[model samples]
Target: MSSVSYHISNLLEKMTSTDKDFRFMATNDLMLELQKDSIKLDEDSERKVVTMLLKLLEDKNGEVQNLAVKWQNNRHTRHYQWREKKPKYNKGG
Candidate 1:
């Protein structure tokens, strides 16, 4: 695996730690990685990241859940890029 993959793997593992702090820190680190222009995730990594974010959304730790929410709503996430668009409401008279 490349360095990016290694880093992501480490963070992903941390995100699953029994300690909430580790998970929170991992989520934050992953978010920072997401913010970088050079971050590249292959198909498997993208799928795993997406799955983890969904799982984290229901994390016992509010902070971790918040980070996961922010990550899911960010434009950099390929799986959730559509979330960046404004929702449309239909009007029925």
Candidate 2:
């Protein structure tokens, strides 16, 4: 894997760390990466990341759960926006 891809993978793994602070920092970093239009994940990595975020919903820490919920909502919003088809307008009207 490329260095950048490896770095991302490392961060994702840390998101599930037992240490709450580490997980929080990792989640924040991952969210920032997701918000970047230039960054793209392969289907498998995307699935894994989403799954990990979903699992974070059940984290013992309330702060972690809140962050997870926020990330999940943002991910869903982006997914829906991409999947939605825009209607074409006719100029003849």
| Model 1: per-residue Cα lDDT at residue 84 | 57
Q: In model 1, where do residues sit more than 4 Å from their true spots?
A: 75-93
Candidate 2 clashing pairs? none
| Candidate 1: tens digits of C-alpha lDDT, residues 1-93 | 999999999999998999999999999998899788678788899888889989999999999999988887784655455455548677872
Candidate 2 TM-score to native: 0.83
Question: Which ten-residue region of model 2 has the weakest summed lDDT?
Answer: 80-89
lDDT of the structure predicted as candidate 2: 0.86
Q: Can you write out model 2's per-residue Cα lDDT over 1-79, one digit (the tens) per residue?
A: 8665787899888987899999989988888888887776888888888888999999998888998999988987898
Measured over all alpha carbons after superposition, the RMSD of each candidate to the real structure, in angstroms, is 8.0, 5.3
